[model samples]
Target chain A: MASFLRKNRPLLVTLLIVAAVLLWMTNRYEPKVTASILLSGLTLGALYFLVASGLSLIFGLMDVLNFAHGTLFMIGAYIGFTAYANPRLILNTLPFALALLGGAQAGRWLGGLLPARFKQRWQDSSFLVLTFLLALALLFIGVRGFNLEKLVAATATATGGVVATDLAQEAAGRFLPRIILLAVSGLFLGLGLSRVGTAEVRQRPRWTSAGVGLILVAAAFALIPIRTPGEVFLLSVSSNVRFVLALVIGLLAGAGLGALIESSLIRPLYGRVYYQLLLTLGLSYVGGELVKSVWGTVGFYMDIPAFFGGSGDNCPSPNLWSWFSDHCQSINVLGRPFPSYRLFIIALGLAMFIAIALLLQRTRLGIIIRAGVQDSEMVQALGINVRRVFTLVFAIGCGLAAVGGVAAAPFLGVNLGLGLEVQLQGFIAVVIGGMGNYVGSAVGALLVGLARAFGDQLVLSGIHLPWMDGVVRMSPSIARASTVLIMALVLLLRPAGLFGKKD
Target chain B: MTNILEVNAIHTFIGQFHILEGVSLTVPQGSITALLGRNGAGKTTTLRSIMGLNPPREGTILYAGEPIQGKTAYQIATRGIGYVPEYRAIFRALTVEENLRIAERSKGDLAKRGDLIFELFPDLKRFYRLPGGQLSGGQQQMLAIARALVPENQLLLVDEPSEGLAPIIIEAIVAALRQLAAHATVLLVEQNFRMASQLADRYYIVDDGQTVSSGQMADLVKDRPLIAKYLGAGYAGAGLVPAQSTTA
Candidate 1:
């Protein structure tokens, strides 16, 4: 029992700190308002955890200082904006394109019925021809039937005329020529990516499916008018459905981008860590600039689909979802009402944390990855491809960042600098928690979030007391610097971070 | 026997420091080759170079008649060469079973060899679920060797396996090596002359990042002056020479 206490002392201390904070808060403010503030803090902490978990994992396994992680989060927000805004259109088009490819496969299967002598030629030419025809058919239907040009025009007009004009002009200038080029490139890229599954590629059973998925992602973008008013495309999608689809798209895009970056840029820079750090820092800027170029500098106020209220008195309750409204409406703690969306975000964060924990602890891949973190050469000598593990870990980390971005989009709005604040919070969380320790990152994120929330509500704000004539006040900068102060104290006391190994 | 691995006068540099200059050796198929030298004699560097951990800047390493100096460590490892580092670089956070499990290429193959491994090191089975860091020094060495054994490797590079081990444990490791040598070729680096001479078929003596001598282990044992010249004074009491192995 003593040993158990010794083993979990850090956890106990953290709990004590949390309890003390809560007790102090309840004493100072109205119970309901404090509860609301605490809930807001937890939601923010959860979002930070989602982002920091990825940064921690990637750094732990690969020793990569991925400064571009926040950039990936920003990209995820944009992906959410593009794909989630019109979930119905993208989701519908996805199946149609897949079915067309499936039909092409059916044509190939039918070709298998031909004479044995013609088998080679049929495979070589007939399959390509069938896919090409189907692709052309998809293009025709997508462009003419969907009125892609008008969609582009409407989206441009709705947002700002300048960025849309540039996008449309660029598309119009190279639409035909670019489509042909993209189709060829997409074909090659698909074929190349398919070959990466070496042993499975030799079996060739899933090659067509792999090819279809790759081609759809790589070439399908060309068919959609770049300037399509996102909301118009999303008109038919239900709120819940739109959010889920957007989350999925954001995750996949972030993961894909991470994979590409790791494989191409980060992989080569292994064993040379400072270079990796510099390159990623440069990439973060590049990524931010690229987003600004496309999306413009203005913040896009995300449409709160499921939520009932906007930021005005017209809607009294900020509890947007029906589920929250029905369940939590009557449970006002003091003089203030608690928003349920923050609670939902907290739950989402916990779910993600559990999923990742299960993934790392319960699976064969997790064991290999954990072992690889300690001795990659030993893992390699054991014949496990350590590089592949590194890539996968990096991708998973980026995907989590995307999840954070999408989840926060409704609350914060999608903007050019979306990743900056979250990224800084994530870094501080990682540092305070312990570099490379997952649970530490989560704990750090919560502490940082709560600190900020408390700072906003209690510390920096001018506090009025009944006994005192004047209000007590602190500088805004002190509140902002509190995150760094916590980190500095942790570093000075426990340099390896709260849970870091004393290497 | 035909050579399984041939290092052709390779020069390896670790940063600005030239570690292995013009070092060369050969391990024949179905035989153990001992690379013996005094402390800091580029023995570990040679092993590391062959494993592609610190690749050679000059010359070549031919494994199974193909040049492998340019390949990454994992690529070299996958091509049927297994490495055990001098420090017993086991995953300390992982369990004994997990350490071996990660090294295994095929699950079925590991299952087949699992019983055989336990038969060799019964203590491993006793602490199968314990973390590698919690293991004693002897057990860690055993675990490191056991991890390398899981993959179906044709060539095994075992570095200083006897380092920091009791004579009794060293005997157990030597016996394990003999059993291992039946299926795969072994390239061993050892400071203990008694063990290296007994276990190795051939010997290569390295001095100042260069191969100074090469012969059958039996012939090497008779060369008192050569042994004294390279192995330092610590081995002189072991009766290899009247003088120390090295002046330093």
Candidate 2:
């Protein structure tokens, strides 16, 4: 009996703490309210797990503390929102894609024309600078020549002298010639830029990337005729299909951006911890600003998909079985009503957890990753390219963050502050769970989630003791600070974190 | 025998400190060549330089008659060179099977050579499912060598394989290396002069990051003054030098 107790002491202690918390909760509040709070806490925990798991994995394998992780989350939300509601915005933005590709190619071409000595000295930096200047020039031309407000007003005057949101279609049609000219100039810019970097010219010309740029230019022209206003096309598709599409697109965009960032920014700065931190922090700021520039500063809530019974004030049925047939916004859980979308969030988190666990435990890639965490240099010497694995892990981490963002859209609403808010929570969870420990992050997230929920409830309803006459209330800020307090407590007791190995 | 690997005046650095300055050596095909040096004499660094873990900034490394100095570690490994790093740098968290699995350069290489590996160290077959960390020091060394043999490597860089093992374990490792030397050329780094004299056909003495002497192992065993000067009198006094110089 003693041996068994000694073996399972950590597990037994955790259970005891949970039981004590439950006993106190049942003493102070109604069972239904407690149950409702528990459900909400789990939902919040699920979101935290999605964000924290990726952060932990990235840090574990690559030793990169990615500040831009939250930005990837925010980007996911915006991408999801566009795919669901304003998909026309994506179609209208084709010219920018063309411009970017054209500008890059032009930068490369222009860089190739520089003297060999200068090219050899500057290398990648020269091409980067050339591309940046060309991009700025293109942005200037876009803002000056095709200002949206001016075009709207001019189109209104040409049509009937009254402004309307749908008037963007006619305005865009009128500037078709100018749009074509911009695309052509972008292609020319790319060709010119390609010449300024001599290494690319000395090495073989990038026929494949150049071909992709040409295809984008062709696509820009093809897509111009079908450009419609964003809101007008919203009613054509089912919300369920749109939501699924949003999720897939959000995941893909997140992964693509992650790969791009790791290869272009983080790859060059490997082993330089401070530079990586600074670069990622700067990227987060720039990303948030970019989102604001495109999507505006105001926060917006996504419409709940019809499969989750759509949005409403009250649920029609309290029966659990009615969930299948009825279009209810809320489901009854333990006789307490809860948002059905939050339940879906909980399910998504569990599924992600299982998938990641299986990936780490069952696959050859998992073996490589596990070994990499100990000594990446050794793994590299063992005939595995650890650098490629680092990039893949980074992309996967970012993709998971984006998944969390898209999932959080309906529950918490999409906003600029959402990135920083979740990022702080994720960092706390990672620290409490133990840095780079995957399962620990999930457990830490749950603890933080539950503490926050109970703290909020305590602030709102106050706690009444058997000996005390009335309820003792505390400030709401305590609830906000609960996660940090837990983190501090965990650090004090177990310095390496709950599961972190002593180095 | 023809030389399979040749490193010429190679200079390697770890961070800012120059670890391998003007170090050079050669390994003959199908033979065990011993690199004898004291602790902190850049013996391990020389092995690392050949493996491309810390590639040399100067001079050339010719592997089977092709330059391989500037190549990355994985590239060097893929070119048929295997390394068993010092301290048995096995992935502690990985199972024995998983450790060997990761070392396979091509698919099914492990299964194809499973018989040979099991024949070499039978204990590994018994503990295949266990994590590498759970193994004893000697067992871990066996697993490390087993990992290097998984791929069809032409040359093996084995570093101090008997450093922390018991005498009995060292004898077992020596026996295993004798069997392995028939299949692949080995460049061994050993502090134990006795083991070096037993297993090596040729020897090179490195001091202060440069090769100071080279000759047949029989000659190294006979020369008492040379052994005392380079390997320290402690090694000579410890009876590491064999009494019978004509044994080899």
* Most accurate candidate by lDDT: 2
In order, the interface RMSDs are 4.9, 3.3
Kindly report, for each predicted structure in the order presented, the TM-score of its chain A compared with the true chain A.
0.75, 0.83
Question: Candidates' DockQ values?
Answer: 0.33, 0.54
In CAPRI terms, model 2 is classed as medium
Candidate 1 lDDT score at position A423: 95
**How many angstroms is residue A26 displaced in model 2 relative to the true structure, after the best TM-score fit?**
2.9
RMSD of each: 8.5, 4.8
Candidate 1 — what's its lDDT? 0.75
Looking at model 2 chain A, report the run of 10 residues with the lowest lDDT sum: A153-162
- Tens digit per residue, CA lDDT, model 1, B1-248: 89999999999998999999899998999999999999898999999899988889899999999999867677788899888888888989988988888777776766878877887888999999999999999999999888787878899999999999997888888888888898799999999887787788899999999999998988877877777788865664463532222211
Tell me the lDDT of model 1 at B9.
93
Candidate 1, which CAPRI tier? acceptable
Which has the greatest DockQ?
2
Candidate 1: list runs displaced more than 4 Å. Answer: A86-174, A183-234, A307-335, A459-471, B239-248
